[model samples]
Target: MTEHVLYGGKGGVGKTTMAAATGLASAKRGERTLVVSTDPAHSLSDSFELALDGEPSAVRENLFAVEIDPESRADRYQSIVSAIASDLRAVGISLSEDEVERLFGSGIPAGGDEAAALDVLAEYVDSGDWGRIVFDTAPTGHTLRLLELPDVLDAALETTDSVRGQLHRMATSTRSMLMGPAAYFGREGGEDELAELKARMERAREVLRDPERTAFRAVLIPERMAIAETERLVERLHEVEMPVETLVVNKVLEDVDEGCSRCRTRRDQHRKRLAEIHETFPAFEIVTVPDETGEVHGVESLERIAERLEL
Candidate 1:
């Protein structure tokens, strides 16, 4: 059974770095690990110091990385819809040219990137090709939308299937009088495809809600706004039944010089926020990463961060 780990938080909170470190740690432990970035503004490549694509590329002995390109995914999704429309036309259900233009000409739908990312994520989870998979999700709002998409899409698909079924029945009933028996068409192929898609979504939702198979880790800084947003994110995750049990507090000032008053004041503020984090999320296992002196990038820096992760 492959384990899935996801790191999500406010943007610029170091979710990508934390996710990369965890992937490195898992690979170091001899697991075949894949680190996936769902952020449109991908930084996983920067963190790993390696170029990546939609297809998984090897980072080292047991580590792989991929960045989901939302624009490309959205284009692919539009192509799929066009194919479905053609299929409908082949079955004697001709869509008006106006309808086709309206559906395809307007470009990617709102939130299409997130929807496409969810589809790809579900496929990866279902593949079970790696021992461990880690996700560097988008900012809190987008991540929440992605998590909720399975249920929303499932419902929409169900309704669409029902309407299609009704149209099929009506067409079948009227075919004899309108275009004769030669015009009759069964929607078996489309129905089968829809059923399979729904099943895939259900499996994805199950995997996400299973704590043993999936771990949702929320990352945050010590700032008041970040903490508040994190609280809301956790609450929403719980509502969706994908509860987060771990919180990663990144960039803690562990060694502020006593001579610098400004540094001391900032450190004191961090300490106060740290105490509040503990008090607020007492049930969560908190992991703190110290503020590094220089930019954290490349495999070596990720390894150092991994050591502090304690994952």
Candidate 2:
């Protein structure tokens, strides 16, 4: 079974940084790890300072990363819908090209890439090659919708039960005419499409909810916004019954003992919150990663992150 580690929180709270560090930790343990970014504004590549926009690249011996292509995903989705439209026409249900495209595009964001990327993700997990996978999801709202998509879709399917059954029968018969009935239902069709999507979402959620299989590591700085976001995230995940596992305090002031005004004030703020984080949430464990001397970029800098995490 593959493990999924999700890093999530409000935007710009070091969620991606924590995700990259987690992957590095797993890789150093000699486990094969694949880290993916589901954010439309992907910065996993930028954090590592490596090129990964369209395909997976071997960042290290056991580490791989990919930033999927949204345009390609949308194009492939269009093709699937076009074929579906043609099949509907054969059954005397005339569907316009624009209408078909609109149907596929409906409910999804303006960009089809996330859905496309999700399509690929379902396949990768099925492949069962990697030991671990880390997903750097988009900010809170978008990520929640993605998590809830399957339930929404299943409800829709139930509401359109008769139409779906007819569509499936029509699709099966059309495929039966050529290359036997096997290929058509197996490839792309109404019932199969619905089942595949439902299964995929549930699988991701299973891993997401499993504490051992996946962990949602929320990152927070000492500032007001980051701390406030962390509190909200904690409550939200609890409502979903998938409470966060770890809290990472990134960019802490180094050398609290040093006699410096800026460091002293920042250190004081962090110390206060650290106490609150521990006392308020006794079940949760917190990890503090101090602000390093310089920027954290590239493998060496990221390695320091693993060091902080003690992996």
Candidate 3:
């Protein structure tokens, strides 16, 4: 099975750095790796100091990176909906464009934009080219919302059948267009947009549920607030049946670096936190990243962190 690793946590806790380092680790092991960013704020590029866009851009010898945004996919989705509404309006249909959008948009039972973005990521996964994919995801709240979308969507669909059936039918046709011999989306034939949406949702559900192949790991600082949040995330994942497999403690101070008394005191606090992490989640692996004074960017810097991760 193809392994996928998704790194997430608090906004400023260095999750992207960990994700990128892991990608570097994969590449060093000769794995064809692609690290993509699904964070709307889009910091993967800045983390690696590499240029990125929707299409995957090569970051290192074997790693490629892309920063996907909901706005981009939402725009494409919007245009499709607009054209669809216009066609309906031309036929003297009573439905307005906003109504048409709400009809589909409201039914997007999950995190509206995140589910759409995952659809994009799933396409890349299905390409059967890369050995691994590392996802530098958004912060906890947004990531939770996105990951939980499939279940929300599934429940909503179960509750409302009358409106969902047409879209389901459309999904069948669109997938057939994309995956079938009769596919001609831009030419003599076209796909059912509703069908496309269904296929996308199904893929997200599968990805979110499959723990053996996908790992949702959290990165944290050795602070009380960070540990508490991560612990809560673990419990939330358990409640939702989405498993979190690893916890990483970043920027750990190795020893009391000669600084002000405050720095030494904080270092002592980290020592205690490490012990707490060991006690709290004994089954899970804990990886430490040293506090580096120099900025961590580029493949060289990532490689150093990868070594610490033993990745």
Best by TM-score: 1
The TM-score values for the models, in the order shown, are: 0.90, 0.82, 0.81
**Candidate 2 Cα errors over 4 Å, as ranges:** 75-80, 83-93, 106-117, 157-162, 167-190
Comparing 1 with 3 on lDDT, the higher-scoring candidate is 1
Model 2 weakest lDDT span, ten residues long: 106-115
What TM-score quantifies how close candidate 2 is to the native fold?
0.82
RMSD of candidates 1 onward, in order: 2.7, 4.6, 6.7
Give me the candidate number with maximum lDDT.
1
List the pairs of residues colliding in candidate 1: none
Assess candidate 1 and give its lDDT: 0.83
lDDT of 2 by residue, 63-108 (tens): 9988766665554444445555655775678876567657656434
Model 3 regions more than 4 Å off: 75-93, 98-110, 156-161, 164-191, 258-260
Task: Tell me how candidate 2 scores on lDDT.
Answer: 0.71
Worst 10 residues of 1 by lDDT: 74-83
lDDT of 3 by residue, 45-86 (tens): 887897889888888788888888565566535544544454
